[model samples]
Target: MSEQDNATLIEVKGLYKLFGSEANKHMHLVHEGLSKDEILAKTGHTLGLKDINLKINRGEISVIMGLSGSGKSTLIRHFNRLIDPTEGNILVDGTDVMTLDQNQLEQFRRHKMSMVFQRFGLLPHRTVLDNAAYGLTVQGLSKKEANERAVEWLETVGLGGYEKQYPSQLSGGQQQRVGLARALATNAEILLMDEAFSALDPLIRSEMQDQLIELQEKLHKTIIFITHDLDEALHLGNRIAILKDGELVQDDKPEEILLNPATDYVEAFVRDVNRARALTVETVMQPQICRITADSISDALKQMRKTDDDYGYHVTDDGYQGIVSQETLEEAVRDDNGDDALCEKVYEDIPIVAPDAVLEDILPETINADYPVPVVDEEGEIQGELSREAIADVLSPDQVPEEAAKASQPTAT
Candidate 1:
């Protein structure tokens, strides 16, 4: 992509959608500050969306969330021109979608975008291979080329050997995988998923969410996901746009929406979800932390003593390897080993997690660990560490540990 395309792939500007012919005739009533109900009563047009504006950045998951009538699904349809906006325009890579003629729009939908629907949208009689290859075949690829790409994507989505099975033969989750593979096989830059995982069972839905995140790490397609579930939105979205009664109420990163809700309605939604599910280790990890190598036990002990600390994280050019503690230092001295170099080999690959592993994803990993859990990035770089004490401080500001609070105060700005 060019620099401009990288910034904002899709931009929605002052969009409005009303479900009635001659909707423009009712624009004056909308400008009169009428509510959705009032506008409907007066103009006989249902207000699907009102003045919605959002910018979807390249290679990021942008989730639009709302209840049934809040216009979440309605807004997503405008991106592919599946349903044109009643007023205003949408821009894709700075090209106004409204300016595209029938052929241009057809090409745009065929090559530039692919959509996954709530109902799976698979042909009942077609085999999984045929369904997955349908998008590429529609673009006029040869049977052999389309099937090869379809086979690759079906395996990518964990449906490797199920190529000959029909959609009805698969479970709801497996069928959804077929839907996802079909969408992915097209290899469109922008992926529109309208409640793609909503119909699955709860456990299956969670699995699908994890699969999407894992796939996104490698592919990084510009994804616009629609969900009414707040937890799903928080787990998947890089930035969330929340709608209430067809108007965008708040647009923010997951943490911002949790820590500072823009309105009472947003606050109400946040209150229901336990914040731990929405927050990851990256949000509250302590970045400016003690870094000690495995061979520096004596030096590390001195540094920890000066700071009145018991633990230190070990990192190298290869990035965060593991952690060390005072107990390990004591063991080192008791062994009477002058060389701490070989001690590194003893416990180089230790993975520890905690008790409430299912109830809450992050907190237990911090609380149950012998020391603070190190926060590693996608590339295995050490960004910071997350601890029970810090989580406590965040949850109960009035009872902050003085040392932890003091250490983080500098970066509060």
Candidate 2:
């Protein structure tokens, strides 16, 4: 939904999983609207997943979330073929996972995918460096080369000096950092994180989430993260899939899910979420049509009159200069001053916000600003303007965009 390129990395099609001796015989019962309780009561089969179809884009974080028995953990295992589906196709980079031979599956897991578990799965006897290097060592790399790679990743995850320490010596957060270092040390393209931060305390969990986001900006690995927490899902997932009773109830971008919930369950999940934190300036920014160059006093006044606005943004070839007021232009004309003198009258102390900044952070600046806050990029080029009205529109539930409404609809498999 965030303008992803037409490249799908993982594709799960018509996936179903049933746990019982005679699972195949109860397929018809599942299709006939039988509940999970009824299915288990009658046939002694536990349905782990049903008709699960998803397309995970390359280098994006796809979070699968649900409650305890919602099948989120059961669903992620299918990605690495740790658990085989009763019926479905698991395609990774266009290769069918189910068709892989034992050796091929082993190769795939070793070379292509690296997993970070809820529990710190580091070897007890191994030092942090040795644990981090384990994956590379298993792949037949020399000790020197593997340790070098592991050290680099360990430093990246903020554990440079702790390489000599054992897993028992580290705190839960630090141990998870080691686990992350180990996964990153492998340099695998696909990262499978199952409740990776759920084991940490709230503060540590939040820190790890921030660390992962920062790392993802550079690594760009295709990540499949599992979580039962909706807030965590919304924060980390580029796309979120909600499961209920072993079935996919909804899948969409987080903003779409928040703005236009597809079902009552999703609505309840989003009801208390802080909308200001979820919505970015890009979602509510208006076009910067009222703009003028420093030399164009006449043009500035005319444009302000046309837009019925008192201020206009003054921009130079370098980037944003400041805001120009109609009163300043009028006085400059009355004094018959030159363009240089008029340019000096432009107010350069205007409030500004980055396009990616959330509304919660933008509120303080906009609330006290005399004019709409200018939304600029890294280059200081003005992209749009965020007015109070635009912010209100975004907060209004009925004013959600039609595109977002359509995006919230379930994908047809």
Candidate 3:
């Protein structure tokens, strides 16, 4: 109803849930009426989630993580109303999930959202194609149309030829593929995946993770994935929420969570993250810049030679824009002086990464480019510079000594 509410696809406010003890069942009794000692004495129950407040953005993958009994799974299950909250509101695109009647809940589950479970909940009696189309069939789709959609989704999940096979006929990985296809076939805007790959072997789990990423790239569906695996959480979650006893310990982008953890609990989860691999030059790019055109290669080269940052200099049509570099300057100078249409041969179409590009993406582009790549904006305008070495520090943070620490140390003390 409000602008803030519209920006949030899903919102939970002052949520509280406690198990056991009928005398203290209500949220108020649990959250406001009793202290922790009193609740333990009366209910002999634990708070599954305590005053949990969250907002999931549209078209983003938000991960919920914690150890067993931490409520990550419970919280995600609440999104589609699989488990009704004991208290507080679960709003889906502004509608209150708690208020949905059985029919409304069923319709919401069938048409508005779809979920993938860790167990790969496929019907053993059904063929892979039929399993994949189960959701569509449940919604009253024609068998022909449902099967057709199933086939298309099966191919997308790399199971095109396995359509006729039953769940028992497939491997664990293959069965999970069917589950993924089934969830996808509904064409829902929001997807809830609860440890969808946890049952697989490590190798298969990694492969499934890649598949999930590729699928997300194509579909851009908003997703909330629940996993206890820290690596998987980092790899998949655009933003992560670390839940401890149902309380939110941290909610932030992966890089921020790693670099600026809010609590010891969250820090332990991020302690081993390869921040370089998880980040991009785009994350650290500076905005202040000047632009020049290719026609003024001489002038651009001169400016680049004087600049100290990774941004060599920006290049544009009317005038040059972005960061420039010595390598770029020399390349431009040499090419400008050369005879054969050097301008066409020298410029590139590949996106120049920003300073924020993580070392993982940077190293490959650097090795390929043989120099720092130009950082560009969404409009394809050169903004600054991104270098292999700058990326290397992220990749090899241990090797790169802290300049601030060095500068601050007492001389020979």
lDDT of each: 0.82, 0.86, 0.75
Give lDDT: candidate 1, residue 334: 71
| Maximum-TM-score candidate | 2
Candidate rank order under lDDT: 2, 1, 3
RMSD of each: 5.8, 6.6, 5.1
Residue-wise lDDT of candidate 3 within 1-413, one digit each (tens)? 77766667888887776766553445555656565556667667666777789999888899999899788988888888766666789888889989888999999999989999899999999899999999999999999999999999999999989988999989999999999999999998899999999999999999999999999998999999999988888889998999886788898888788668899878777776776667666664445443434345566555545556433444545333333444655665686653322243444444466454555655555545533456765666665555444544444356333542243245784
2 against 3, candidate with superior lDDT: 2
Q: Determine which window of 10 residues in candidate 1 has minimal summed lDDT.
A: 350-359
lDDT of 1 by residue, 1-413 (tens): 76655789899999999888878889877777789999889878998999998999999999999998999999999998889888898999889999999999999998999999999999999999999999999999999999999999999999999999999999999999999999999989999999999999999999999999999999999999999999999989999999999999999998888878999999988876766555666676677377765455566556556655666666667766677676676677677652565245433243433222322465444565556776766676777767666676555344344454454455655
For model 1 the TM-score comes to 0.80
| Deviating ranges (above 4 Å) for candidate 2 | 1-6, 335-344, 395-413
TM accuracy, model 2:
0.89
- Cα deviation in Å at residue 317, candidate 1? 7.4
Instruction: Report how far off residue 296 is in candidate 2 (Å).
Output: 2.4
